[model samples]
Target: MSVNPVVRISKVLSLLTVTLLVLAGVSACGTSSDSTQDTITIGASLSLKGDFSDSGLGLKKGYELWADNINKSGGLLGKQIKIDILDDGGTPAQVTTNINTLIHNHKDSLVLGEVITGLAIPGFETADRYGYAYISPGGLTGKITAAEKDDNKHNVFGISLPIKSYLSSFDQYVLSLPADQKPQTVAFMGSQSPFATQQLAFSKAEIGDKLKVVLDAGGSYPEETTDYTPMAQQVVNSKADIVVLGSGSSAEAGAFIKAFKQQHYNPKALIATGGPDEGKAFLDAVGGADTAEGVFVPNSGWYPQIKNYQNDVFTKSYVAKYGGTADEIASDTVQGYAAGQVLEQAVKKANSFDNAKLQDVLKSASFDTVQGPVQFDETDHTNKVAIPFLFQWLSGHLQAVYPANEAQANPEYPKKTW
Candidate 1:
């Protein structure tokens, strides 16, 4: 109907305003919804710099590898996976901050654990506060699991063997040796790191009485200590038959090894909680393979040749992507990939991206990864299905050598002189 020009103009303006408001609303909703529907973002804080940089970088590579593999083969739930990794600089405080920022920015993103236990603990706590599942690859200390028990933080899950049982296979193998071959005197040396300290405590309780305690320096020094000659001298002075070092990194282990070599102190057998299992990095840190000969380290069911879920693919992919032989692949890389595996399985099983739903699925489900089978204990969320193995540096490679059944090579006992 014909009307006044002024009235017609006012009505036209009103209609245009309403149309714009509806378009803005749809745009806002799409921005938020498309993020989740098109891509699943995962968050993690890693020690990409500082002391744990070597392992942290390896872990980052593994995470990226997993994401690449998933994206190439129809990503999780038909959506691409995006990993938002932040550098924690190997500090506990920064890890906490990184995790907080990650959760704050993307409330629905899942969290992957950090490299060291010290960093992972804070990361886990932050994720728990947000009620997000935290799947850790290298947080093996029992303290975290114990804290989870006390606080009932079932959101934290460890993909590696618990620290309490890290040395069980080594202990069993030593005890099974001939009476004369069995170490009669032992020394326990560990940095003040929770992972190392816990391993030291367990070692003392498990075999302290069986063997003469020559030196118990388990909690003698802080993890950041640069000089290890003093402690190495103590071990030499004690002249222990065997040395069990609760080292937390390849650098720490290398320091002690170099100190021992300088003093020409050689024990019948020397095993560390970490370091040697790091592959070529450990060998390089300790002055090549000859110097690392016969050293033992515990592994959480991962080796390049192990016949496990997609191990061949993972190894081949790692080599193709990183340009290194299978023997040089770091254990940290395997752990990181396994953590991704667990998360991928949980998402598919629940058929949901909700963190709460994924948590529930992880609690009761068993998953297989490059490492092996992973089934978390209902009470502690520690992996109970995978058995830790003792690996020794033999013929320039770290090979499994314990429990008779899993032995890839007979242990080179009475370790060769450095």
Candidate 2:
């Protein structure tokens, strides 16, 4: 018991070394098996607040509904799926930060896209930096697609139709009209936002010399401009046969509609880039079903009637969960759900959680969603299979009225006066 101090210290050190080796063995065993992992997390950064909040919330519902359905079906790859959504406040910088945290800190298995092109671009760039694929509900701007071509970054994919072609269907419908019914003068008014301006440009190019330009004021107002009465008054003054508004939201379109009504200026046709496609929100903004009637909005895909992949199931599930009729469902919600549908198919096809494998499957496969068949272009990653259609409000319902094959109803020309 009273042995030399040096010998006692040597015995204690030997015991400590043996204990460390035993603990290290346990750690190694756990690491090799990775048995504790039980869930696959998908993350998204959305403009849940700020300018895009309304659309952002719609997209959120879509994502949530998809995750709920997947979980109910026994989850993906035999593991429960969890979604981590963060609000970007409609800011690009915030989107970048949220994306990094999701990919690096949370170690999310996949990342979904934002609501608009401005917010989505940053999110896509950040995801690309980490070698992750970016699948968005919207954000089909030319810059993003061009970047994909010029930079060879085939990682960004859009669920919606390309921005430049959004109004192409409408143009074709107008040009096909009889000489007497054809509109002679056209007016273009839009926000400077990339999506709005691009649609305006495309409409002009497509219409060409067939229509005289009464007002070429597209991109005349800043995106943040709240008051549209002044610009709308100019359109009324021009006495244009047709008024094409490139609105960013239902509210913007509603403002213009209200102004036109006040001035008692009813053009032969009044169509907007957005707004009327938003269902109840658009109707409410334009002062109920009566005012909404005859308003036209181009649709990339997805109407309540189209029998696309799992659309019936999606519509029922959405109504059951959100308490709305199928017609009242926001198009943004469909876009969001379609984005998830793409991701789910890619994961199942690859049979692995690896981002690289998912990207490869996405590039080669054509997946069906509520928005119809989605096949991304190898170069731009934009959906190439879905055809854009023109939709108009008829008897309080948004009906596809163009592209004879896809038309749910005939075009309501020379729309009713407000």
Candidate 3:
């Protein structure tokens, strides 16, 4: 049965070649499977329509900037992350519907979304319903954070401005003032708004025996607001030096500030708790740094002072990749990026898309944002709090002036009481 030597050699070579082919095919499949598993899914709910459209679009772009950059870096946890977006059309009812769909579709996708706080409330509850961790990129209300402790708040989280807490924190400085400088009575004025409600809730909790609120005045939105002059005069007559604004960007606030100055009832402190937008717009609208000059615009961070912040990695890379000058964009974009980073971290830690697991990871999660380290409490998820920087209009820019440690520039007002 012995074959010729040449034939035997040929047969042996053919067997070796077939064995190698089988091994190569198996190796190729293993690589393909690994590649498939390396992908992670992230989702968002944005207001793509209705009022607040301009700001909503800006927020969407900000989130995209972070998500795209992270994916470019091959994503987190050895997985290439993908972001899925849904537009809520700026209606709470519509927002609720969108959330339903998002949770259904992304029951498996990690949610990285926000509703512009005032209008995006339904989407917030949606996160609560599905137990999916969603970072609200622009919504800042304490009620939302309080919801985290409720049975319905399992997946609710936000990286938005702490407008309420910052307001209360700012009042601490007001309370500590020497008795002579501190006002015996104060005024709380706000345009009628949900934002105002949060401001009031926070004030009730924090404003101590320092100043009494004499004039509890407010204006309705776009109506009953024929003029804010009367309200302004009332605030002036109350002899209150400290005025806590209710809403962040109330046109009435600017009008009141103007009226107060015109009547020569300058207050020692004009504290605004709205996002930087309201603060900037009001300061700019009031004209002459001297008119709204002595006032303080309270916010977490603005891009101009970001160079002094500890977030060099993101700030540098973001400014370089994004076309806008860092001076022009909100330093808040850094926080938006930090939120995205949190999502990345959760996914890596969870190692699976199980909503429960992701929720667990976000719970008790403590990590660094562009501003500072953020830790979520089991009962409360408000993370990353820093001293509110009071920006006084110095030169043409709103520069940080408080906490001497972070004073980028000197205060425009050494002291004032109108």
Candidate 4:
């Protein structure tokens, strides 16, 4: 046995070769499951079909444009950028499933998801479970990200003005008026959904004695409610100096406003929160300037008059690419673009796609977007600063009329009485 030393050494070398081959094969197979180092992939769940399609489509287009532009700029970190998306039909349950599939089945690195607050809540949960950042373009209510008591909201951030912030801005607008010009009595009308409910509660707490509440018409109006005549009648009959439509679709808001006009209820100020208050659909539904004149809404990401160098460039390019003015682009469009901008900036700062590293950068940084400076509060993960302003419909154009410095046009108080 001692005379066979060379043969024994050759046998040991043969065993090492087989082991190395097996390990290499396993590594190759595992890498194939996720992706190669040649590209970075991100996924999202959107309400591409159903009641939320308008906002969802705008979001999709914004994301697509971002991806295209990044690829044109030679991509990120020397890798091509790819975005994968699924339609959730505006359902929270579906959004959960879509996000789960994207994480577990597709193994994506990050998710940009959901416009509706309800749907975005579950999306945030799913993204957290996967240990990825979930940035929302809409869904600004703090509750959506569990900012109250739960610490799980750290991975969720957004572009929409949070409920507290929006209410504060609205309250500031009311107080900005001279004592004689300000309305003494107001009514609150909105849907019973989480967003509207949270907004109303905050409004009451923030508004305090600044204005008297003469009517509380807000309730859980089902998404399917088409006729708002009863609610409109209630608001009009209250004879309040200001009537605030807390929540409704653009069409629903238009219906209620039309009914209010028909009833000859001419309040000094008319403001709305959702749908008819923010997007282009509101103008179309309310029959243009003739009917929508002097209406006010929280900026809600739709005002084209919020001027800045970045916003001006974005609006011009958006108009050129989409063949319409910046106003034609929904807030969701800008939101989607801003979300992408945030993601890009974070990735660039970290110089890698490692989720943990990206998270650290996002939590600690501020981004300059078309919407202005966007910084996430380190604790709540909700945006700490936003360019929220109150906008009014003047003639056929939307004009910013609050916060003094940001106002594009003076408010037309005591809108024409019917």
Candidate 5:
């Protein structure tokens, strides 16, 4: 049965051709599906190992929790999300490097997370240049977004209160207070950072003819200094009726309050903005619940004690997962969750992962999340209602004490003297 050599060779070539064609068909199908489907990837940069590490870790937890929930619900657009993150070490240069790595190396679709205000500019610049839509759950620098918008850089959105609105709104609330309760004189103190300075300027403008400034003491103390006694002494000497401290961090804010108390110079009201007044850390830093009495801070997130439909839902879920009350969770945690919510909603409304389309959805839509209604102004990307009621420390917990309807307890108007 031996065949001619040419005929045998011809038969072998035909079989090889058929086998190769079948293999090519299978390969093409696999490649097609891979190109069109799979997990969606997002990128984030945070100060996970440096000065702002606590809040940065909180933000990461919030993002992870949101991602887990979405995946459990069958994922977004039928694809699971993978968040690629990097620690920036809380430096502007490091932030810039991390952002570049995320955008260029990882080729991620979106950017999220928080960096300190002073260190965020480079990140903003990178997002703009690359045209990756970005949002932060915690950054509050109005000028960053405002400047970007002016230059036609519309890829950025900030979830926290805008610097302008944050200062003006607080002053507006003070002005709305009953005439007799309003303090005649005020003292302003804080880090001399750009955001703090802007806050002071805006508050001064809002309080025109309404209050007098006795001590404009701030920026005098370097951020590295732990002892705020020198600044506290100036504030005490001024005998200001009201004291407003715009601290850069919880530790600094707590130090200022402790120093003020140690000096036995308690003003009628001592209101503070920034990290220190937000949650448990500051209270603990200043020597526990008993010593933290009467301190007032804005209720930026709906705490567990607040009775609201949204608050109940978030509180229940958060407590069940983390085994702690709402106040125990870092304030930035809620913010990071809110940011993920906004991003998910935007993705759904747009029905596309295209940056331009997502940006359009963000600018036009209002999302109702655990924090409440989130609406952004397209011009500057400022949140319309980021900050809600003001809360005062009562007993060992924070209680809503303003707007009557939202008040959980009566406010200690004069803030008790130490």
Candidate 6:
């Protein structure tokens, strides 16, 4: 009862077509539901209140701007990525609670925000426990990454430059000068914050035995120490040609400048590292920019024209949303936005959001973000490769002065005679 060869072939062809059609239907259905799979969650933790609010606020705005720009542009992976923000009121206790809350709230998957290094010190375990990828935008504590030698880190990524970011720049800046103008004797200053000691030590390691650090004094800058008469006089007596102030607050630098100026001893060079605003505040509090002429500091993001984080679209939308000019932006915002872009690219590359599928897709993830080229090291889930710029204060404004070609302005000394 064998069928004819032609009939048999016809039946086989029909079955093949039907099977292909069924697969097509299933794939189409999956495509239709991509909206569900495209959704990715990002997280943030920062001080919304208390002492560090100014920078914290800026960090928040940066994150929001990053998130807003992404969401407006149809999001990533064909789905809108939602940012889950938690304010940690500038206290370690609050930070711990917020991390726990975000991990619990997100139900397993998680993203990270700026938590003071000290506060986040204990929470890495929680992230490892939950399989969350954590990125820190602001904390530069070198230990964060160096600790990778231990088992606590796998998903932890630190976007900010290590605490040593400033040490080399300041050292190089001084040494780069003509040998005649180089600063062989300098002063290192910071108020007695818990982090201050480590910062000074880091700066000194670079100084080595080559430079003479005349004054390495610190005290609480937030309290009522109106006059810096003693500290200034120390700078004067030591005949320090340079001053490197590393206070987290400007008032500390202002006091040192005022006291030093009164003594009629202006050093050959002065450098500060509280970012741009801190430099300006120091100038404002200590008469004007004239006295603090020869200072350099690190700043946030690239200029808008460069189309970096301050790109045309991001700049326009950020100003419009925040109701202010876009001159000042935190690196955190750039980092936050970059994180979103990473998630988006990962989701799209995966072409499916089965979490497991997403993981495979992101393992080799890379993308062009507002900050620049972003990618992750598989062993360590951090955007470790992107660093910050060294800014110099010339005339009245802070400008990028490192990397040779990126020099927006050149270094100069007002009181330090050439």
- TM-score, per-candidate, Cα-based: 0.91, 0.91, 0.73, 0.86, 0.85, 0.74
Ten contiguous residues with the weakest lDDT in model 5: 27-36
lDDT of 5 by residue, 369-399 (tens): 6666678876777787676556677888877
Top lDDT prediction, candidate number:
2
TM-score of 4: 0.86
Clashing pairs in 4: 189-246, 190-247
Scanning candidate 3 in windows of ten residues, the lowest lDDT window is: 26-35
Worst 10 residues of 2 by lDDT: 27-36
Steric overlap count per candidate: 0, 0, 3, 2, 0, 2
lDDT string for model 2 (241-331, tens) is 9988999889999999988888889999999998888999998998988888888999787799898899988999999999979999988
Using TM-score, rank the candidates from best to worst: 2, 1, 4, 5, 6, 3
Model 1 Cα lDDT, one tens digit per residue, 1-418: 7899999999999999999988865543212233447887888999888888888988899999999999999988999988989999998899889988877765435778875778877888878877778998964577787667777677888887887888888888888889978889999998888888887787788888899998989989988887888888888899999999988778889988998888898998999998887778898889998899999998787788989999998999989999979999888999999999999999899887767788888889999999889888888888888786899999898899986798899999899986
lDDT of 4 by residue, 78-162 (tens): 7787889999998889999999888778767667877677788888877776667788886467567554347544677776667
Question: Where does candidate 6 have its weakest 10-residue lDDT segment?
Answer: 27-36
Q: What is the C-alpha lDDT of each candidate?
A: 0.85, 0.86, 0.59, 0.74, 0.72, 0.59
lDDT of 5: 0.72
Question: lDDT score of model 2?
Answer: 0.86
lDDT of 4: 0.74
- Candidate 4's clash total is 2
Q: Report the error of model 2 at residue 160, Å.
A: 1.9
lDDT of 3 by residue, 347-418 (tens): 667775555766787776665556555556455555544446666655545667765577777654334533
RMSD to the hidden true structure, all candidates: 4.7, 5.1, 9.9, 4.7, 6.8, 10.1
Model 4, 199: alpha-carbon shift in Å? Answer: 1.8
Expressed as tens digits, the lDDT of each residue in 137-253 for candidate 6 is 543465555555476555555544455554566676666677676677877766554345455676677774668877766443432355656656766787877776665546666
